[model samples]
Target: MKARIYVTLKEGVLDPAGKAVVGGVHALGYSEVSEVRIGKFFEMELKDSSDGERIREMCGQLLANPVIEDFRIELGNS
Candidate 1:
């Protein structure tokens, strides 16, 4: 089984890397681009796809910052 995780900053949190990318995009003549938010994507292989609780624990403990960032998990057959 395969598990995919997406981690992103909360709505009010500031993202410096995203801001830098937006600046670069504008400089390249894409003035219509307004904002960009950066995030993390993780893929893992799991022995038991039904183990959602353990995956959530892993995310809360290490994968994402619970205070400033939110994460979503997607599980699918490999």
Candidate 2:
């Protein structure tokens, strides 16, 4: 199975990198870019494990930090 994990900062968190990207976009004349948020994408391949709960636990424990960010995992047959 293949899992795609998206990690992103929660609301109210100040993202300097996102701000920098926004500033650069504006400098390049993309004034229409009002907001930008940066996030991470992780693609993982795992063995065939029927335990869905364990997979979720893996996401919470190793794949994502629960304090400042949130993660969504999409699992599919590879």
Query: lDDT tens string, model 1, 9-71?
Result: 999999999999999999999999899999999998989736888888999899999999999
> What are the per-residue Cα lDDT tens digits for candidate 2 across 30-62?
999988999999988888775667777888898
Stretches of candidate 1 off by over 4 Å are none
Q: By lDDT, who's the top model here?
A: 1
TM-score of 1: 0.92
Go through the candidates in order and give each one's C-alpha lDDT.
0.93, 0.87
The stretch of ten residues in a row with the least summed lDDT in candidate 2 is 47-56
lDDT of 2 at 40: 91
> Lowest-scoring 10 consecutive residues by lDDT in candidate 1?
47-56
- In Å, residue 13's CA in model 2 sits off its true spot by 0.9
Q: Give per-model TM-scores.
A: 0.92, 0.89
